[model samples]
Target: METALIEYGNFLVAGVTVNATESTDFAAVWDELLERVSDEQKTATAKLQKVGVLMPDAADEGFTYTAGFIVQGIPAVAALGLTGVVVPAAMYATVLVEGPAADSIKPGFEYLHSTFIPEKDVTPTGVNLEVYGPGDVTASNYRMYCWSAVDGVESPI
Candidate 1:
């Protein structure tokens, strides 16, 4: 349960975006998105790493989910039928979730919101990031870093 405070730079991401609620099945959503972009992703240049951007929905209890890949610059998403998101630079509290991603994300998030953030006394900026690098995602030791944006440092949102 180690947590770290770090600075994240603004970056560009391109992927499938969907409005998700508490009842939504994340695995299904990701599978659908992957099916839509699998081919392009294999050939896409400058595509850095996989990422999941969670932007809180002020109008609902859920968040806007963007299953994407960080790109070196503006990505040509029009042809892929994907949306481009500009993740603003901000300070974040991060936790490394180790294990199969499907099984670890929820618990990781719970820890962040329930214990870590409260202990640090930082206000979440309503934006969260899940970063994944190249690896065997199904491996038991797979890792994903969850970053929660927090107030205090100046951000260019």
Candidate 2:
């Protein structure tokens, strides 16, 4: 489990995401969101990524369920106009998750939030990010690389 700290610029993302744990169909939601952005001719230079604490409902108020965050070349101003969401800029800690993106990724996140964070004695300084790489063709198989920023030095939790 290798970890690294990196700086990411601002970007825009439009997606239909739910806060509750009612077994959401993320694939469908992601497709819809991508379509909407495409229709608007939103040229996304930054790839799609997911970020948030594992079992967010169990975390404190600020921490919660999975939230989608995209990193694009567009600046904050332009991104806000396009996505209608205020995205804050900051550093991030990145970690790669191998295997299927469905349930497997959740365990990785859980480890980060529950075990790694406390073990490392670090707190999230900026928005969490999950970089989705190749292998997401099927529901049962995919790869997701996660990123979460922390104060001082950003490292994998």
Candidate 3:
């Protein structure tokens, strides 16, 4: 496993908060979220790489899932039915996850939270990002980059 550290800023994204758990039908949720993001992008004639952000719920073990895309500027949050999220400037451990979106995401995150951060000398800030790359996105050969905020400059191998 190879890694890169990057300092990324916050973003305004159009998304919905879903109660997601281990048994959730993730594929369905992702399909709708991706489609919604696509529609929002088309309607605005704006574009950016789509992302699925997993934020831990304060009340439950499940996550508050936000599926959307990053906007260059502040988006019309209310008008577009999108919530503004400040990604906050932070360092991240980036890893490439390539394969079908459905299959790749779960294990990718598992590695990040379970193995990557613990094995490296970094602290998880709890904000994780799933960056979708430009390609035949849903295909088995698709590509994505998973980034997790950390507190140190430790090498993420």
Candidate 4:
């Protein structure tokens, strides 16, 4: 996976959050979230995109992940029984992954952390963002953007 360094503005998102450990079933977590947050909620947004925000724990054991929708402004998140997040504006090392989500996401992430960041001499902020399209995710050729926020870019493309 090749990475491109790009800057993005702050994004407002609201959805259900989960404390994800190694044992957590991500598919089930996403399923439950999608169940509670309707299609209307997910689509009625400023940016028509769904995102998975991963914030690593202080000890690096697990992550607090939010399955969310990019919204326009202050939303009534509590009324919908959801949590809101303001993804800060920053420079990101991004990779476009195309394949089954199960087969692609983890390996792409590993490549970024273990190879790209280290080789490029960039410092990770420990915030990873997954931008998903409104398509058949279970399909073999699902597409998504995986972004890792970094402090500095050794080389920007």
| Best model per TM-score | 1
lDDT of each: 0.78, 0.52, 0.72, 0.78
Ranking by lDDT: 1, 4, 3, 2
Candidate 2 residue-wise lDDT, 1-157, digit = tens: 6555566655554333445443665555556555545433444423445443222333544332333445454464255333323345556556667776766656665666676555666787535655666444345556677766556554334
Local accuracy of candidate 3 as per-residue lDDT tens digits, 25-105 = 755766675565546456562455678887777775667777776765554555555666656667887888988877887
Clash pairs for candidate 4: none
TM-score of every candidate relative to the true structure = 0.84, 0.57, 0.78, 0.83
* lDDT tens readout by residue for model 4, 88-111: 888888888888787788887888
For candidate 2, list the clashing residue pairs, or say none. Answer: 50-130, 93-148
Worst 10 residues of 4 by lDDT: 39-48
Superposed on all Cα atoms, the candidates' RMSDs to the truth, in angstroms, are 3.0, 5.7, 3.6, 3.0
Say which candidate scores most in lDDT: 1
Question: Deviation in angstroms for 143 in model 1?
Answer: 1.1
Off by over 4 Å in 3: 34-46, 58-62, 154-157
| Model 1 / residue 112 / CA error / Å | 1.2
Candidate 4 TM-score to native: 0.83
Which lDDT tens digits does candidate 1 get at residues 1-157?
7788788789887787789875777677667778877575667632568888898766857788888777655536655667888888888988999998878888888888888888878888889888775687778999888888988655445
Of 3 and 4, the candidate ahead on lDDT is: 4
Q: What is the TM-score (0 to 1) of candidate 1?
A: 0.84
